[model samples]
Target: MASSSKWTASDIPAQSGRIAIVTGANTGLGLATAKALAGHGAHVVLAVRDTEKGKRAADEITAEHPDATVTLQSLDLGSLRSVRAAAEALKAEFPRIDLLINNAGVMYPPKQTTEDGFELAFGTNHLGHFALTGLLLENLLPVPGSRVVTVSSVGHRIQAAIHFDDLQWERSYSRVGAYGQSKLANLLFTYELQRRLDAAETIAVAAHPGLSNTELMRHLHLPSAFNPLIGLVAQSPAMGALPTLRAATDPGVRGGQYYGPGGLGETRGYPKLVGSSSQSHDLDLARRLWTVSEELTGVTFPVG
Candidate 1:
């Protein structure tokens, strides 16, 4: 994987007439991704938690790309009902969606349960998107060449797959461990979704923004000053967005492909084709996790 991240927004394919949905688009990586997609001519849907913040982000994008059609829709990724409603609204409003970028996520936080009662990180980051994809399957499948891009994290290396026995962390839970589990679920969902997409000839891919300065760290106890060090090493939100854009728009991208930075240790660099961990790519685990996700979310993706 060479430095594919070297490509700038100019490198993105023109996206006229395409519709896209980006979760958690009010700030951080999600906002940057939606802005870039719309900048390239896609009509972007910003699925956000805070309408006010979403408006601010949407305003900024519109100011930058006057032609950028960004719509703000309320979403609480922690709640399955909200995910369903957002997807339903999109389905009724849009004839088709060419791209769905599952980019919103929560980082480490104190032990908490979602509206659905699942662990917060796992619930918001994985199950939420999992259910959203299911709800949007009909519209997504209608468009030929459509793509679903799920974002995971390098922290996926910390956990191979979730412990099924503690899917909700009923027994015991640690913040970092839960975070790792959620990230690992992202990979499993990506791999499994890719498998199903390929089997049904649908398109699904996965990516990760190397490292970036985003509010994703707000959940961390780190001081604001440490963010500068992160910025020094991390890529800008636009830079971090390359992998996602590539996954969504690159014509040559194949199902199951994963993209990330090409720099040293994949910490920061231009986006490029990158290899996932052996565990992240495990087929057996992906299959099992898919069933678990479906059962937990009570929404099976309409892959066929």
Candidate 2:
């Protein structure tokens, strides 16, 4: 892949007739990524948790580019029912999905459980997207030149590895630790999926938003008030979206590639190919996590 350190939104290639699904597209970096894809003439599906927000986001993007075909669909990554419904709907309507951006995520939140009784941050951040991706693999696998781009964070480096004994943090819960584990799972999932896809010769890649300022910090704000400091110094959502956008559209990119900013501490800058933590690239754990995720979500992928 070419050096994308100097690349900007204008460098994105035209995507006319392309179909893309972006989870959490109602706001922040996900919205920015969706807008970028639509700007290139892709049929953008804004998979959001809230229908009202999804519609509004779609309208806002279409307003900017009247010809930027956009659609709003409900997707609550915290719930398995929601993931299944969204995937089934996507399959029924769209014959192919050229790109799938697993861009939505949640940051640190006070200890709590999701609708499925798993830790909120881990459940939503990792398991939800994990199940969603597996459910939609059938449509994605056969699509010519299709790719699955997952959005991760530098927080992945914040945690060492998954705590198998207390995977749900039942013994004790540290918000930062749980968040790190989830983000790390994103990378693991990405790499694992890529390995599986490669074995099946399908496309799968991963990316990180670095330390961009986005609504993912909404939870981190109320409970701990840590977001203010991050916001004051963090990159804007558009800047954060660059890494994801680069991973999705850059022709030079390849499966299993990891992208991030080229700035100080990789916290912010233009998107470029980057490295990931060794744990994130661990094939054994990735495979274990995949099996665990399938059993938990009741979603089996045909690809593997």
Candidate 3:
């Protein structure tokens, strides 16, 4: 990897002929990621919940890069049925997948459950991605240099716990705490998935944007007075997306490794290798989460 102090999107390797599927590609970090990949040479798929919005995003990519090959596929990460349907459609259309970027997420929303009755944050942020990845693993496993890049968050270190006893947050809930657990789960899932893919061609890596200004934060519901403060500190979506882009494209990135901003407190800066909370490294915890996730989603990885 290049020095963390200076790495940028220009460092991305040529992606000619690669097939990349990025979730939540309609806006924010996901949009920035899709644009970068499509601008390079990859055939990009914008997997989103809203086809109309997805079409607009695809159009935007093509407008920016006339030769960019972009397509839209409906995917609602909050629903297992939607995930399965999208995965099946993707498999039938494309046998080889070079990249799967799990970037869509919900943050700090009013307490609610997914269509499957999972806590909104945990369901959309972790379980949905988990099932989608498992269903799509076969398509990526056979392709050399393929990767699964999951987007975690710094929130994982902030009051985050598995809460296995109340994974659904059914008894009590703190929006911030619930979001933290979901982010932590993202890391647990990535690490365990990488372990399973250790002998396969595909690799699993994780990244975090570190406080970018984007639509994902709409649910924050902060006072209008704080908007300017947030704008001053938050980086652009393109800047926030560097860590993810690097994780997805950097050849030096290894399985189970994580990338994030290099700035102080990792709030905003260029991409670099970063560390996660100690709780994220518990092998036993990861295994347990993996088993429970399989039971919850009813989606199992092909790997043992």
lDDT score of residue 278 within candidate 1: 84
Residue 274 C-alpha lDDT in model 1: 84
Top model by TM-score, which number?
Answer: 3
Q: Please count the clashing residue pairs in each candidate, in the order shown.
A: 2, 0, 0
Per-residue lDDT over 1-304 for candidate 2, one digit per residue giving the tens place of the 0 to 100 score: 3455687888889999889999999999999999989999899999999999999899889888888999988998888888889989998988778898998877888898888988887799889988888878887787777889998888898855788778889989888899999989999988888777765535788888777777776665444466567767799988889888888988888889999998888898898888989888788888888888888888777765
Q: Give each model's whole-structure lDDT.
A: 0.84, 0.85, 0.95
Over 1-304, each residue of candidate 3 has an lDDT whose tens digit, in order, gives: 3675888888888899999999999999999999999999999999999999999999999999999999999999999999999999999999999999999999899999999999999999999999999999999999999999999999999889999999999999999999999999999999999988878999999999999999988998889999999999999999999999999998888999999999969999999899999999999999999999999999999996
lDDT of candidate 2 at residue 4, scale 0 to 100: 53
Best by lDDT: 3
What CA root-mean-square deviation does each model show from the true structure? 2.1, 2.1, 1.0
Model 1 C-alpha lDDT per residue in residues 83-133, reported as the tens digit of each score: 888888888898788888999998888899999899999999999999999
Better of 1 and 3 by lDDT: 3
Model 2 ranges with Cα > 4 A deviation: 1-3, 199-201, 222-232
TM-score of each: 0.94, 0.94, 0.98
Error in Å for residue 221 of model 3:
1.9
